[model samples]
Target chain A: MEKNQILSVAISGLLALGLAGTANAADNKPEMEKCFGIAKAGMNDCSGSKSSHSCAGQASKNNDPMDFVAVPKGTCNKIANGSLTDGGGVVKKAM
Target chain B: MPASKYTFPCVAGIGLRAPHYREVLETLPELGWVEVHSENFFGGGAPLHTLRKVREHYPVSLHGVGMGLASATPLDEKHLSDLSQLCNDIQPVAVSEHLCWNAATGFVINDLLPFPYTREALDHVTRRVTQVQEKLKRQLLVENLSSYISFSQSEMTEGDFLAELTQRSGCGILFDVENLYVNVRNLGVDAEAFIKTIPADAVKEYHLAGFSERDGCLVDTHNHPVYNEVWDLYEHVLKHLGPRPTLIEWDTDIPALPELLNEAAKAQLIIEQCHD
Candidate 1:
């Protein structure tokens, strides 16, 4: 085989490997869903049920049952004392 | 890597929230550009879909509210990765984050919180800013924060901190006029002094939002329209720093699409008057 042909084959192999690695990384990401009443004070992803506040980081109280955190979809209900519905569970005030 | 090729005209724009996405896209409003909080679209779904459609019509600036650049904790790799992916997908005209710490130790605060502006904090922020810029391959604009409280620790002013951060991190300034005004009223910060200290050339964008007062302290709430006082201050900014891409941000109780556009028009008029 020609030297150039060998070099081309090696480069193609590395490119294939890099592409596969990226695909694996993308596949590894867990499915995430917003879990309310899980976010601590100042930790909510965005505004909760409160109509007074318009955007993120406006939780007036710690773990206000309205606030939410992005957790693995199925895992939200599984987390100890975690509630998926806003204001459904006991409010865990921020420590 | 050379400061993302994306750029916006030196005009006024609006922060496109979820509620107005459909209207803005359908109507194709006449405006300079539009911005959205980066975190809102971090995940793929309707938000990203709407943003993609909006991008076809106007320039989009990805303004971040959760990067927490100065957080004492290490930079959030996952958050940075998500942002990088979004930037690649959207190819935003400009990207920005606040110069505040949202998380500390183990707790992550959703709001932009103030921190002591000491040399130690400056070093920490500079490193994080550089990391973000490298990841996005663009000049990330760092915005000033509106604080409800002040730290008594030894340090410099927020303006001085931002100036030095820009110098050290090769980042640009977002120049939130409303935030500066909030600080001026709530914290007694000198807005004019701040304008002088910052390098005007590095100010890539300006943010104009409304504030609400609580217990004699002004809160950076975007529900109301830009007040006359903030507009007056904006004129001073345009005069001193020159006109840049300005945005009207109304997050709380966002009114109709026309109202938002009207606010942008007001900013546009001011921007035009400055040039004339």
Candidate 2:
């Protein structure tokens, strides 16, 4: 086939993929919280405010104030020192 | 024609990172070819889509950093399979991995930690390279690593190990010139001997990058432009090994596309001079 024909196929494929992605997003999306000040060393979700973990799971100590542990939306506050904010404020985003 | 028909052009290219993807695709600059960290595109959404677009204009080389070929632990089958899938998708001009290890035992180290140049390590790495080659059904270019330390336990020099590795595994060499420079400066590696020991014919590519110095050790940080000393060293390498597809690798603090192309131009000029 010619160039335009090949491109049409690719365009159609991308459209279908995009549509499927939209449907999946409408169906389900995970809601987790970046609960700061609760992650044990080496178990943080990602690099912290101070970058305790450059690579994932490279944190050096337990409950590092800078590190975070991503938890369920409503579950962060119940755990001690677990703040939804980077450095916790009273105004929290919707769970 | 299929993209698979493209081969890495013997000129200068840059390490295509995420930051400049938009600009590169928009401008479609005249790059000799582009190399990318294989792990970065494994996710296969926007990254892979952009790469497909990039492949239309340039020959792409899939350079892997996480294979951990010399790692003592068993090979990561999943990683190999992902790479094979990527090769199938992209039909890259060349597929290469570093001659270093990242995983050991239960932990996965993010950095390309060095290993001893022992006979045992060679045998292990050779077997792993053969396995990767078989799986990919293509020749894999194993890059020499930049190390700050050396092992005194046993065995030969790195160049010797790489020479034997190529002979045994039927693989090619991605000689990172700056890595050798770092070893020479930091660990007192013999530069002339290294230049001589690597079978020139086995060398399929060359890498030039700038390094950072902390205290006294030279770190293989590909952020800055190719240093004057490294350019001098590369000139020496070209006199011996001749020229191949050379790359300008800048991972951090990536400048604009023109700046990168300017760096590539320097390599292109040197490559042209060497050709003359």
Per-model DockQ against the true two-chain complex: 0.06, 0.05
How many Å off is the CA of B201 in candidate 1? 0.6
Q: Give the winner by TM-score.
A: 2
Error of 1 at B179 (Å): 0.6
TM-score of 2: 0.76
Is model 1 an incorrect, acceptable, medium or high docking prediction? incorrect
Any residue pairs clashing in model 2, and if so which?
A: none
Query: Model 1, stretches more than 4 Å misplaced?
Result: A1-95, B1-5
- Note the residue pairs that clash in candidate 1: A42-B109, A42-B110
Q: Give the number of the best model, judged by DockQ.
A: 1
Q: Candidate 1 local accuracy as lDDT?
A: 0.81
Q: What is the C-alpha lDDT of each candidate?
A: 0.81, 0.81
Q: After superposition, how far is residue B135 of candidate 2 from its true place, in Å?
A: 0.2
lDDT (Cα, tens digit) per residue for candidate 1, span B169-256: 9999999999889889988999879999999989999989887876687877787899999999999999999999899988877788
